[model samples]
Target: MKEMEPWWKRSVVYQIYPRSFMDSNGDGVGDLQGIISKMDYLKKLGIGIIWLSPVYDSPNDDNGYDIRDYQTIMQEFGTMQDFEQLIEEAKQRDIRIVMDLVVNHTSDEHAWFVESRSSKDSNYRDYYIWRDGKGAQPPNNWGSIFSGPAWEKDELTDSYYLHLFSKKQPDLNWEHGPLRNNIFDMMTFWLEKGIGGFRMDVINFISKDEKLPDGEIHHEQGYGDGSTYFMNGPKIHTYLREMNEKVLSRYDVLTVGEMPGASTEDARIYTNPENQEVNMIFTFEHMNLDSGPNEKWDVRPLELVALKRNLEKWQHALHEVGWNSLYWNNHDQPRVVSRFGEDGAFREVSAKMLAICLHMLQGTPYIYQGEELGMTNVKFDSLSEYRDIETLNMYKEKRQQGIAHETIMSSIYAKGRDNARTPMQWTSNGGFTTGTPWIRMNTNTSFINAEQAIADPSSIFYTYQRLIQLRKIHAIITHGSFQLLLPDHPDLFVYKRQTAEEEWLIVNNFSEKTNQLVWKECNLPQTKGNIMIANYDSPKLEGDMVEVRPYESFVIAFERGK
Candidate 1:
């Protein structure tokens, strides 16, 4: 089979949480104009693609995830003309636009769902899942991702409808042929409107098991019985292929599936070039490094070796068949400097190190909003202070279970969506916007805002600028293969990137103390370069090997002849 083009091979995608990115209108929320004003900044940063989060018309139940209309831009975000202008402006700067496609479910207020729930025999009724109760109880013991039972009883229809997330967000019935076609039509509509592709939200969840059997039960939280039946189901490929053939294949669109529970093998079926279903799938395996087997909410001191091992496993497994979208933070994730690095002290050094560690690997790097500035999570004192639906629901769930208020508050501070959703810090004069921000800005804005970072050459901003340039300039870093070097390093993270012509060793000290690795065992000759890029003030090269200072990182260019 001919090799299909991989989007991650040489791509640089920038994710924008539209509401918090910038507020052009003084309505205390970001709109399309805000993004337009910042186009030059993204273009200057060398961003190839801009992945805009949902700006569709919505009830804001899930903050635009619960979309009401797929065709119209949300009034709060501005009109269709504004979105078109933004797209035109972005394209002029050579940046492709990718919009969020939250097709897993729609708000109950959506015309289709609203009509579906109105009557039993309505044409739109089959558009959603409606089942009879099990003798006054739900169909099964499945739990919603938000909290409580996945099924919500509707008195008007005398049936329980399925909602995997918030009750207002009802799951769509993909098995229905007409409903599937409608979704395809909508997708085609967007593609015709100049959208490069979609960032599929929970695409794997769209295909559930036909049987709807209950999943394995858990102790504290109830099991998602329906999820086991539905997620990565037998008919998933059939549905995806249909969409690909009818809508996606026609346009040179890029699709990245935000798949949560899919295995590497399963993901390969969806993303492998031969499969042709999608360009890539975002896996949560590495992101869940801090969580327990059951996904406990508590924090565990990060295990770097284990993290490295997991990443290496994936890199080796998919090196040939599929591509990985390298990212440490996204809108749904806590800041990388906080979660992966020592965000409090020595943050500058560790932030640069983490950036080098991920960016130097063989894959496309996704830079989340404010990530280049080493942004940290905001500290909120109470649940009331948070605006995210997920965080608020978790707080309530924990509180009802008799968890201490302080304990719940601490978890919110550490794991809340609001952590990543906070407004981007642009300047010190309330860096986010002219009017008050929709959400409070992180207090560290005073010290870590963008204007200062951009002006200072040694700041994380410039370090990232160099990283992007390196990727753009080096063929090996973009298309070469990766091998984990010295996987068992105690305090250091080391890896090698190699192509036919050259090999580059990337080493970094992820801890507070200095560390050394003897490269003699690896049989690689001592490397030499004019200090290509280093995070520390000074790196001492003693004879053959180099010692890395606390949280320092370096990418030393090497070649056989030199």
Candidate 2:
């Protein structure tokens, strides 16, 4: 008999942003049945897991991130029966459903919050963080992630409630034992329903510093910084351990925590198997490489070296201790082709190159909806066209500060979350819905739809499909030791993945200009090896100096099946 490894270890996860994926009833909002309609497409793409973004009951404050009920499905998304059908249908195709668990906060309309705000003496009053104001001012000068103050003063009790995000989404008090119990119960209920796993949303931010002190100014840039208190808080690991004991440990579910502001050292402990916290974590370090130090909206062109160093840091850090969730685009991020790759004349090749770069890493790869189709970011003409709360707030604030409309719109085009929220492009007209979409569609859908990609064998979709297949067949890819080949290469991202018997050299040219790669100093073989996969036809690697073409990437199998 063969020893069984964790199923999630070998699986590729495909994330579905329900609102944009597909709509079955022509309701303009993608729902459970819409996802079910695409099960065959996902299976054909070879993803073993589908990380479904929140379909839970919500008021759409931040899309579906703000939840009102744990078990109930959103009315726009359909009923509980539809959700059950989705799970059953997905499982039949060897695909497991990993729900987005947003326990860090809940909608203000949640029953617990409704009762907690009704009276200071209510049983649920302690469920959320509420503090008396400091005289006439807020208890602390904390700012919400969305914008402005983090605290909302309730007139009923004359107390200010902490909300790290939007005011309508109140932060839950993890210190409360009963609150913890309720969270555990919710997890058990889902697991018992036959769902495969959970993708925890900002799980690290659950435990906040009890003191709730005033925020300090940024060291490098002048700005108020409030993330210091709640990010990887004092009691986070303790709470995770308790959560593991109460819920996670009993089930063989794949657990991934979306941890922002988590250092490499912090992730090592959070995902280390022996610690019994989570299976892996999504690190934002790589994603922040393009942003200015002061803020995410402060967009700066990412240097290839910066991205290389950031990814190498995480790959090397978690090589022995934990697992990494590899991704370039998600519902909250701009499309990778637009952000990191060439989304112009070289869009297809560049998208394939980017896929090779991420898929070659020693981590579970995640493909966001339409990512396989090489989706590009949308640049809307006006603020009226945008719907994201963060982008709208930034535009309003910047305009108030006398910033030019072009300047703010440029930032919105580069880093706005709305870029990722656009309706999925299925056709030239965006067959996402029969009716108008909830958000604007990427106009590039005319040429970059999934319909066209699936028809072409040379498309980015096939490259991702082949990459997923490689993971299943090649043991070297799954558990191989990673070594950065050219640590300081300006335009080339080169690395080697090796097991005890096999070695593979993965080369990527991130620049539009052809780069000359000299791996002689690195002691790599001078001989050209067999190409396992590539974005370009007849890629040349002659003698010592290899010329990598514009947005080209390929894996050279020097040692295989030994």
Candidate 3:
């Protein structure tokens, strides 16, 4: 008998933000041609899957997330033929393409939304959530994730529509059977085109509470947290099961849902193979460890205790029945090296440390573009320099509340989405385009660019390549049991992975100060083990004590019971 292997189990995925990845034809924006040109680069990096952010036709209100048409490609991204060519080129490199699926909402300019709002009695009117306001106010005090009332008034219909995000993006009504069929049909259309799979955006929020009711106010501004009503709502599991049975089951592909506010309990059910909902899930609990008391915009220093607790909880909870999608940097997040590492003098070592710390865990790891090169956060001098709608809206809200400008700007610098959306540093002007870039290029490109890192053997890029190769061939890294050690250690993250024949010890010093690792506490033999990988050239391993330098990381493999 032979073992059946899932392609995603040992594969490493690299996420590309198309608009910032590269630009072809001097358009000052990235396109499919640019991605096709980078096929060799991704292949050399040892990435098997490429997760590209949405490139569907849109009004560009919320970037390409507000899809205007699922069947068509965004004009800025090039034609459908260009995309087909990209798929072909990637296939030649043995890389699979996974698209961003944003079915939660659509742009107001979408044909369905335009017709749904055209008249109260339109056939498509029921395709969206609509309600008559309680007098002049909205139906409820629900707040938008982008910072305002969740309801938007439509003068033509004399009703308010639910929009959890920007007003230009109207939420879809999953209660309508025909609407769900439409979504499934659209998904099948792309799957049949030879695309690998999908990375569903805000997928858990598709279902909502049956009764529309006011929520308790959590912020001083009087807006309520309506996430309880929509996030992981009553019929989310049912919808996912239906999606799986209808379209996903027929194809061998990966499906990962971006689920916010989801707990380990919810994840077990959402991703359990028996349930057939999805292959894995991307949870935000670990990412929110540094968030302030009230909101994500209120930034604070990352705490080791909270970070370890959240990560270990997910790892243990999903070890038996479900899977995890590991990542530290994404389009919606700040750069990992800047957020949790020393990005100033020790950038290279810290970036490598963060990569090994996350990649060695028992999950499919995702590397955001520019992350392997140790990209740091952009330090814009003024709010006018920012381009993200979420950042601009929050700035307006904070300014109106009599908050100090400096304080608000500081928080934005620490938590803004733009910190990750900046153009990839390739060369002067980031090599993103010949013309002007859509967003201002980070000035640090002179030193932090890929052109420089590719030439340096000791750069973060090379370290990441080796880590990816390790995961591909190491059985323990893929299917071993994880046990977190030194849970109380403030600066050192230590863990052990054990398989039937091999045991591995992984240690990472995430701070700028040297940390002593007492091997006696590890309960292993005093004999040295094989050094599988390490950020530094030589790490000292004394009899009972090992001195880990600032931002040092290493993985040692030993024969079990040796």
Candidate 4:
């Protein structure tokens, strides 16, 4: 059995955006108590880990990513006691909690940032990047991840400070030993407090490109190669290895890095089981399918071949060397059904099909809140209704550049973070909380809430429940070797998971039209085994051929001696 490996590699993780999960106090905001109240539901869903979004004390500049204090829960979420209670309750149900660690930068209001900004000569000033502007302008034309110039001029200190996210999130000078030590100490502090590991936020961006050279300017966008300098730098591996040695190695914890722009080779380096920096790192190659060469947000139509190719690349590339964090939806992505499948007309069928495609594959499956019930994107008529800082800044930047409102709206509809940040729907009343939620709930909450999904036997929620159960029951899906069966099928996505005992053929109809699958496509004897699972209630099968419905998904499991 090869000892079955660690639980994280085989477990199912669920992400909860605290503000929108459930509002327990009726204050219109979701809190730790709200999460506590929902434990039994998560337990039933078979989630092994609950990767919670940041609930740390913050000014909410980047919505809690800019932390003012790393040790306490934000007032909006509840007290430290409340968080501890949530942890206790989750443990009772055997669900581990992974906290969000936004370590790349800190809020301008943080004591460290304040001290660093007070005077260039201050001892803490070395904690942050402070440089004289290039002749009254920014040091370079490098742009912020959010928008505009990366450098912010400090009138008090007469120096320009670098902020990759927002002016409020000043980039920490990780090159300084004292600042790095502070970060390491904070991580250990939380671990000592009975907390599990972390979901590191853009942690690779800590090491900056010291040259700060403004590379060849992009025609429309001004910056070039800045991310290359800051992301996955020389010190990144050193810092991560040190953290593993000092903190993570001491505890049985799960760490997933937000390593944006990481390639397959990078993943191997970061997650090589022998001795690597972290447990796993998230890559963005698959997530960038819709964007153009410019990497701006654009909703290009998704091609099944391209999607399958990307999935196969990562799945096969990391099979023996590293592991993958398999997911299609998260805090930054829109609902899977709405973005990847038919949402309105074939919502139920398509949702189930998408889930089966990912869940049965070889990797850990991550289900974001409300994804099981087939949540859709919010339909906002005006940009004023948007609350996300990144979306708002992009809007402002485009508008200033003479971009039309419709053009901005088109991008928002296709690629806005608000699509995923909308409140979770508990019922048709849109009452994610008793009071008004900080962000508006999506309108479809009326029909697609958790209450309704749990009641329906064949709903996407239970479909996922079964799929996850199947993965656990069948070790082949968990750790078996995978082989993509048909590489060039236009409307079909097919693959096989094989182990010494059993071989499973997984097929998906990635289209809205019917497709006929020949039995030969499966490369199995007709009487080998029974159908394990299917998205459609009654699939049309004739002897050696199977007729698939629109967005149909099925798994056929064949044991060698069956």
Best by lDDT: 3
Task: Supply every candidate's count of residue pairs whose N, Cα or C atoms clash at under 3 angstroms.
Answer: 4, 0, 0, 0
Per-candidate Cα lDDT values, in order, are: 0.84, 0.90, 0.91, 0.85
Question: What tens digits encode model 4's per-residue C-alpha lDDT throughout 1-562?
Answer: 4664888877899999997788888898888998998899899889889999999999998878899998888999999899888888888898889999898899999999888888877899988888888887888777888877889999998889989889999988888988878888888887776766799999788777777777556646566547767888768888888788877888889899999988888888888877657778887887788778765576687778888899888888788787888888998887789888889889999999999999887777889998988998877987777888999998887888899999889888878988998888878887677777788777777799888888888888998889878877888887788888778888889898888878888889989999888888678744557678888876688876888889999888887645
Report RMSD (Å) for each prediction in the order shown.
1.8, 1.8, 1.0, 1.6
Model 2, span 396-448: residue lDDT tens: 87887888999989889999998988988988878899988888788888898
lDDT minimum window of 10 residues, candidate 4? 216-225
Give stretches of model 3 more than 4 Å off. Answer: 1-3, 525-527
Error of 3 at 326 (Å): 0.4
lDDT of 3 by residue, 371-444 (tens): 99999898898778898999999999999999999998888778889998888888744788898988888898
Query: Weakest 10 consecutive residues, lDDT, candidate 2?
Result: 217-226
TM-score of each: 0.97, 0.97, 0.99, 0.97
Positional deviation of residue 153's Cα in model 1 after best superposition, in angstroms: 0.5
> What order do candidates take by lDDT, descending?
3, 2, 4, 1
lDDT of model 3 at position 554: 95
Q: Which runs in model 2 stand beyond 4 Å of their true positions? A: 1-3, 219-223, 519-522, 525-528, 560-562
